[model samples]
Target: MASLLAAVVSAVVLALSSMLSERHCAFGFGGFQCNDPVAGYGSVLLTATLASFAILIVSALIATWKLVAWFRAR
Candidate 1:
């Protein structure tokens, strides 16, 4: 259950990041502008998405371990 929740949350974050990226930074002219709000926002989202993925991975590992233990006990 925890893993499932994590997976769903991670998927949502990924979708949001993709949507934001698609909506911004499309023009063929750029060179690392520090004052770009879109870039800053994107960076924050990227960090969040990465952290969510890490949580998802850990949850998955826990779920798998529990399942294996249950099967072994049965």
Candidate 2:
């Protein structure tokens, strides 16, 4: 349970960081261009946020599921 909560939190952080690393300009680019510093960084963060946290989220879910199963088995 604790680990799952942690994973959920981690996912949220990664997702949010990935989003914040980029500065969205509604008027600067006239909403036509998405201006984000170092496209590479944004891409990397997005990938990491999705991939790395995906792993954690899956693992955490599995752990919780197993825990539940174990408890129910008893």
Candidate 3:
């Protein structure tokens, strides 16, 4: 149970960090418009979001597997 809670908290933190960083970007101007000469900002954000979600999913799956095993052991 503690592990599950920690996993959830970590996931929430990851999501919030991503959101805050994205908000700080200068691309808030009309519809994803980034004036920076750097390329792949959007792609980077997409990758981060996907990675975070994947971690959250894996954590949840592990928690579920643990719970099932514990129940079976009873």
Tell me which of candidates 1 and 2 scores higher on TM-score.
1
Model 3, 1-74: lDDT tens digits are: 86688578768867864674466444555544332443336556555556777777888888999999999999
Task: Name the best candidate (by TM-score).
Answer: 1
lDDT of 1 by residue, 17-50 (tens): 6566566634345532223457656556556657
Higher-TM-score candidate among 1 and 3?
1
State the C-alpha lDDT per candidate.
0.65, 0.62, 0.66
- TM-scores of the candidates are 0.58, 0.47, 0.52
Clashes of 2: 0
Clashing pairs in 1: none
lDDT of 2 at 50: 70
RMSD of each: 4.1, 5.3, 5.2
